[model samples]
Target: MLNMNRPNDVEAYIARAEADAVKIPGLENVRPRGIASAGVIGGGTMGRGIATALLCAEIPVTLIERDPATLERAIAEITSIIERNVTTRRMSADEAARAIKHLTTANEIEALEKSDLVIEAAYETMAVKQDIFSRLDRIARKGAILASNTSYLDVLEIASSTSRPQDVLGMHFFSPAHIMKLLEVVRTSATAPDALATAISVGLRIGKKPVVAGNAYGFIGNRMLAIRRHEAEAIILEGVTPDRVDQVVENFGFRMGPFRMGDLAGLDLGWTRDTSTGATVRERLCEAGRRGQKTGKGFFDYDDQRKPVVSPEAMDIIAGLAADKGIARREWSDDSILDRMVLPMIDEAAKILAEGIAARESDIDVVWLHGYNWPRHTGGPMHYARTLGLDTICARLKAMGRTPSDQLRKLLAAPQERQ
Candidate 1:
């Protein structure tokens, strides 16, 4: 151990000196940049970008796609991304060319057999991921790490499908993985501590800030979005137009309003109920084919500049639907809407911490700041809550006639009960 003799406060100094030894289970032993060449399975937007990120780090990448046509498309997408990087001066022409050359494409799974690390960016389906991992388990070289770039689903379940659970972990990269800086590293119970350490180092090498998360459904960011969506539903049901909701929150700190975000991210993403929350207005919107921007309509219509304008038709629909459901309308008080959206987000943030899904409030905050475009000025969702006082946030929810989920309620009451 390094000397702990240099401080005024004995315990504090000793603890400071031991920081490197204080890592969680899978992260206790790790070194940066181990097994070089990375493998990216699935050539979709996320996969191609991940491959590019690895290449930018000077790590050769083997990007695998099942379809010959999609393989060609993935190559083109990688080329486009590299060109953008070149034009922006983030990379030079020669470096870009070298990176592209280092990127090898394959329609064959066995190509990944040579990679020291492989991230499966395949479809969201559990079975699909299971099939991919089953193949990787047999072919991946010994000691090679296998990771999943799953956005929400349980990483543990995906890791369980692989032969070596210890080397299988979640490497949740944000969309357009090369540009987004957050990479959530998830460790299952069976994950090897050293492997987790390795994953963090890998994240750093590829220019990402990896926040280690405990395994759970939806992990951190997307899981909390449930609370946001719920409040959006309540407000819309309370006679607020989708456009109004989007505008309010967008100004509140979000880069885009939730509904507009829904459109941009594709309403179909939330429409397909992996689990049912009962039929709601959102379902109706989906049925009507009013998926956000790509359809030229969602909560609002987009112009040539992609600047959204209030949709006459969506307003008409919102009013009609409210009337049909006997939901009343009112001139929305802006603070009320802000409280409704943010308080629950705060509550969920607290519960996520209470459940050990996140390592710290900073981890949760960084995820939002980097991946979700949550305002960096606010320091992240949890940090914003801490600054506001959890008790105050919880009370705000109560005053709005909102019933926070049980987890949040327990979280809020626990401290009071403890004190």
Candidate 2:
């Protein structure tokens, strides 16, 4: 029998050769661009950065906010960013001012009547998105493209809200959309070729590298992220310390380890949204009100420097939980922890491609490198997988008894570059 506990060293060579053939499929089948003016809704962090990027591209953008105070705050944030750019000699004072002038704000969505493109940077709730799209269908100009900066949520359902479903698409911009180059342009079956083309063009115009993805829940980046988080949490539940997990990854290449990332981004951010799913094991710590860095507690404690130091409180909690479960604390070897985490990611990537969600491995790699902050020099997750092999991915996954979880099992069952 094959060594299910480790990678298939023989197949790693074959996978590397296959990944080397990765390329961009031509958009020859799609309409390129017919619209010019752009508008963005919501004035949250993502909205502000997206608006700034659009204005920087000199495209007239109406930033829709719910209230005057929000508009003011967004304007202040945009101004602060521009001033910093000027200070760094990235842009002249005159150029910065010019870009700032192109931004217009409104307290209502109806103000976007003249926009050729309107992107909702609002809440990720399905109801809210459907309502917004319904309203936009009534207000937005005919042939105008409608886009969403949603990380997860179904684009097809949002498209269904409008009579012009063909024009609805996803333009998932990473946080601080102005800086991140990767953008996932999700296309539903009803989405028109022209709309997708325009989204890609606009992404490029705003200095983003847009990758076309199929309309799937969470799409490529977030889907991969879900699996990544699952693997991270699983290890912690076993025996590996957060610090140890971080050490193994950082030593391999990542700038920061998984726990540090969870702390900085807030441990409660995803869990709060996932409460009903029961897919996550959050109730234990969350019910105790130990949210994360904001509450000055999480996987680790922080001092004035805000550096992550292992929390005795957390260790106590882990111990109590383990004892309650009658589970012995097994010291996870460094290799076991690293193999379990990384191989699952590669397995997830194979599943991602097989589902036809991401058009190619490069797209998956691009999102990981630019958006999710996966170590860049390694050439993204897919590339990392190729470096390791298809058989190796399968071997490790089988060894760990991981099969994409219920959320992604179908993809693994598909015919693809997996052993």
Candidate 3:
């Protein structure tokens, strides 16, 4: 059994797991393609970050934005990033100059024609991505890899838009891509071994901790996160204050809790003004312009420094929503709140493993540890669950009116010696 009490043991396990994450079983012998030059489509936050990462890696980059105004803005923002790096001494003045030389801005897809790899960080809609890929099919070089930085859209469906599905994949970078370390290199059913290998190579070249994930809804980290968010929202509706819930999670070692993270990421993400109704807490929040820290309010209010304070207005909104839906309010212990928030995510990880969305349980842990800021000392959700014992987890989940996943049941039924 693993020893959670020893800090050294936990650190060693994480070290080993991170090393193992890059090794895809079947692609062991496949050589990664050289990325000589790259192209990035879109000039939004994600696109600019990706371009910055590429430039910092000393790769020649052509950043394509079809709109003249947006393209101009992207160039300015990327220049500011380079200037900041120099000011912070992260990059020397000479290095910043070279990075500027390496960057090229264009207003057309055809600019990517000679690039070795092209990534589309366009808007996150099926139609928009499909359109981009269809254009890339004719524009990008024959053997050049095509990737989508889509968070949740189907990469396989996106790949189908091209004649070369083998050359297509997903490079799901976290927000603030230039700084975040994790990259989910998603491989579709038709992605070639070398294609996958090449993407992994590029991820490493840009100083990211890359993990191979099978294409699925939300892939690894976000898939499990969806469950945690659902449970977090449910508890608040059941009468736990958002602050109390966030505090419980923070005490459990997360950098920030779900509501706080939502607030930071903006509650209005993917929410539309045209179609929004007060059907859910999030929708109501958006409706009220409590769109998050950007607007200075969400589940919690933010001051000038962006520090959060409990908002009576938000609490009243939550209470009203619960009452409207006829949900009974109840008192909750911190332990209960933690269990409800975390256990469902553990169950979702089981489903991810059983469905081969992740190659190993350790890979899932790596995703959480690097991608989602899962506490390092506890290893990760899976490692923490194992330390808690599968029996205990199943019992808790069952008591909460949830069925244990078949994967968890199998692990439970396995002989103790084998387990």
Candidate 4:
């Protein structure tokens, strides 16, 4: 049975949880290079957060932008953040002044020549990131650590743009980087031990929880998220409403459901108006200018104060898709809703573990708990699965006519091999 007690059970659970993290060979022996100064390319929201984090850790930062206006805007944003912290008592007056003192802004890539570590937090495209890495290869000081803040791009391909592939790694920070505690230290095949060490050390210095990830598309969290997204959309097509789905997930302890999250993040993230057709609900919504919360409309409509309510327009689109696809509609109970949504995530996590993309099952759990806001009371998805009994989950997957991944099957076949 699962232990769900508080305080009394917390310490023992934490001990077992920590033991679940897998250790990479030779990780302990590598001594990380000291970071005296850092460089952050791009002055967007993500770049500003990276620069602010370095400054807060007492490491000086040289932030580079493509033009003078953008550079100034980033500088102003950083300043405003510091001032707000002071006003809110998150930082004292003197501390805020000192943090500002350690920051410098530049418009040229060459200005980062002396930095010990330079991170590219530019646009999330191969062309843009490769161009930045190529420039850094020639300008950055010899032996400098080069990193990318890409959330989904290939780290190896980015490293190939630079001559020192061994020194290149991915330091993927969750959005709003300064506040988020999770830092995915993505290691490529050629990543030197010391490079990984430096990334881990820097993460720790900045008060972040660091987990090592292999060089795979979307790494751990995003890969599983893709599966969950597909399943969410599939169930909607079958009969479930967005509100019902959102409520079920929220009751399970998530901060928000997928549809609400999509609205808040904006449905227009990758959607281009010119290329959009009314084939899919999201595409149709974007085509109709129902982008997201910023526009006061999306899967849910917002009030004057921005509280969300169900939208008739969105329901109409969903109905249209259901009619076109000829999917049967039925009443979806909360249990079925929860199963359809979360089971795929567990399956994908199993595949990731089997493929060696994640070092441990708990590491995947950590990514979801901190980055994706999986409920802490549930002790992460993997632990929760164990609580449900792995055999029971496997049986349900089979009963649903789903083919379990090889790793999951093996794990089920061997009782002692379970994490």
Candidate 5:
């Protein structure tokens, strides 16, 4: 068994796991096609970041946006990003100029026809993505690899929109795609070997640590993240302060706690302005215009400097919601709070494993480690569970009124060597 307490040993384990993640088994002999030029659909934050990353890699990029104004803004934003790199000394002025020269913008899908690969970083809704893919199928040239940057929607369904399902796949990049290292290369059942290989190769070329995953909702990182977020929200409703919950997680080694993360990401990300019903805490917060840091308020209030402070208004909202739901306020110990926030994620990871959404245990670890900023010392959730002992984890879940997944149970029953 690996020594979890040794920092060097943990680091080495993570390195090996990451190295192993990119080596897809069946595609061992398949060569990756070169991605000389690329196209990115949508010019939003993610699309801009992706276009910037491709430009930095010296890959000619055509960024497509239907709105002329949005297209102009995207071009300006991309130029600003390159200029910022020069200001930060990350890129020389001359190099920045060269990178900017490679970016081209357009207001139609026809601009992507000759591109080697086209990644749709459009809106997250399935209908929007499917419509884009349907048009891409007609516009993109034969053998051009088509991909989606969808975080949760079904890649198979998106692929189904196209006649060339073999050319379709998911290249799920985390926020700030220009900087974050993790990339989930999701392959649908119909995805061609060469197409998958090409994505993995291009991901490495762009300085991303790519892990191949089966097509599934949320893929690996976000699939597991949904569980953690759900539990975090649940505990707050039960009377644990959001900051206290955050403190327990931060103390456990994460960079930030769930509520803080939600605030940073903005609570109104998918909430529509028209549907202003004061139902859930999030809806109530949105109804009040406490969208997030952008508006200087969210679950926590932000000062001019953007640091989070406890918001009495937010607290009242939570309390009122709890009372409305008839949930009694109860103080929870730090350990209980930690368990409530994290154990469910571990359980969901087990389900992901059992369902074969992740190729190996280490792949899941890689997803959490690089994508979610899982503490390096913990060796990701799956490894952390093993370090805690499968039997111990199962017992803890049982005590907390949760059932361990069948996969976890099986791992517990197996020989130590297998675990």
Candidate 6:
């Protein structure tokens, strides 16, 4: 059996990899035009956050919205954020005033014409993005870098709408874009080398820890996150309660477990009224109108103040789903639960490494450390896997009755390469 505990020398290894994680590839040759001005489309939370970061970096920004009402709301929300930061001494009053002065709001897409860099933080749908990029292609000046703040959509498809595909790339920012340190600078096959360099330059300017990822669904962080979430949902259907699953994960050093995160982000993220089958726990919860923290209930119910409490209603739903699937109900040990949740992510990372979707294993670690809040001391998933030993991880996967990917098999064959 594989040892479940981390090796004693894990910290020493972490120290070494952390130094290599932040280096951007092909940066020395990148002589991107200085981004003195920027434009942000769709003045929602993400747009506002991106705009704020630009303003704070002393780059003037043009924030565009659909109409007068939304433009007003976006401006108000942005001003309030700056005001609060000033009040808390996070930004000086003079600095806040200067940032506010640097901001410009517009109700027309044409306003972005003067921007040296244009980031479309509009809705996530492909059609909406396609329309925006198509228009930007015409409105944006020659040589201006066009970026999409898309989380999972194909950047290549989005780039196709525009004639200058080389100028296009994905600048994926996590939620609360201003505060989050992780930015995935996704490069498509057609992305210009200078464009990629420009993105790395701008991302660092805004105080973000940027990592380069290839053009793929979910890229590096989200692709592996999907794997973890799939297994987490599966084990739930096999008898684990949401709270118990969350507890084991939280005990592993994550601030919040999967279920709690789902609740906070809302169960309705991907749920649609047209797809109302109630097949999964999330779909059923949405069908029941438990839209999560916003609605006071989800996988866990909330008190009036919105603190999560284990809901008997949620347990009943889980039990019914388990029965429907013909899975026997049973208790799970913390160790078993932790392994099931984490090992799949590690396996997926190995596959990502083999596929060259990420530059280095440490880059994947940087994505998780800053993007997903993986425990920093563990040195991200790839480092954690190294501590477990590739051979040991391969054996554990087989013992868990899971099929290891070919990439995993190859890694096991040359385990010394991992070191």
**Which lDDT tens digits does candidate 3 get at residues 310-375?**
999999999999999999998888888999989899889888987989887778888998888898
lDDT of each: 0.77, 0.76, 0.90, 0.84, 0.89, 0.84
Tell me the TM-score of model 2: 0.86
* Superposed model 6: Cα runs more than 4 Å off: 1-25, 412-419
lDDT of 5 at 383: 79
The TM-score of predicted model 5 comes to 0.95
Task: For each candidate in turn, give its C-alpha RMSD to the true structure in angstroms.
Answer: 6.1, 5.6, 2.0, 2.4, 1.9, 3.0
Name the regions of candidate 5 deviating beyond 4 angstroms.
87-89, 273-279, 412-419
Q: For model 6, what is the C-alpha lDDT against the true structure?
A: 0.84
lDDT of 3 at 187: 96
Q: Largest lDDT belongs to which candidate?
A: 3
lDDT of 4 by residue, 1-419 (tens): 33644644534553455444435568768889878999999998899998988887778999999777888888998888888988999888898899999898888889999999999899888998999999999998888999999988899999999999999999999878888878888999999999898998898898777888999999988888888888887788888999999999999999999989889878887688788777777888888789889999998999988888999988888888889988888887898889888887888888888889987777877888878888887777776776676678887777666876777767445542324
Please report how far candidate 4 places residue 271 from its true position, in Å.
2.6
Identify the runs in model 1 with alpha carbons over 4 angstroms from their true place. 1-28, 270-278, 403-419
Q: What are the models' TM-scores?
A: 0.87, 0.86, 0.95, 0.93, 0.95, 0.93
User: Better model by TM-score, 2 or 3?
Assistant: 3
Please give the TM-score that candidate 6 achieves against the real structure. 0.93
lDDT of 5 by residue, 22-80 (tens): 87878889988867899999998899999999898889999999888888888998999
How would you encode candidate 6's per-residue C-alpha lDDT over 287-318 as one tens digit per residue?
88888898999999999988889998888887
Worst 10 residues of 3 by lDDT: 410-419
The C-alpha local distance difference test score for the whole of candidate 5 amounts to: 0.89
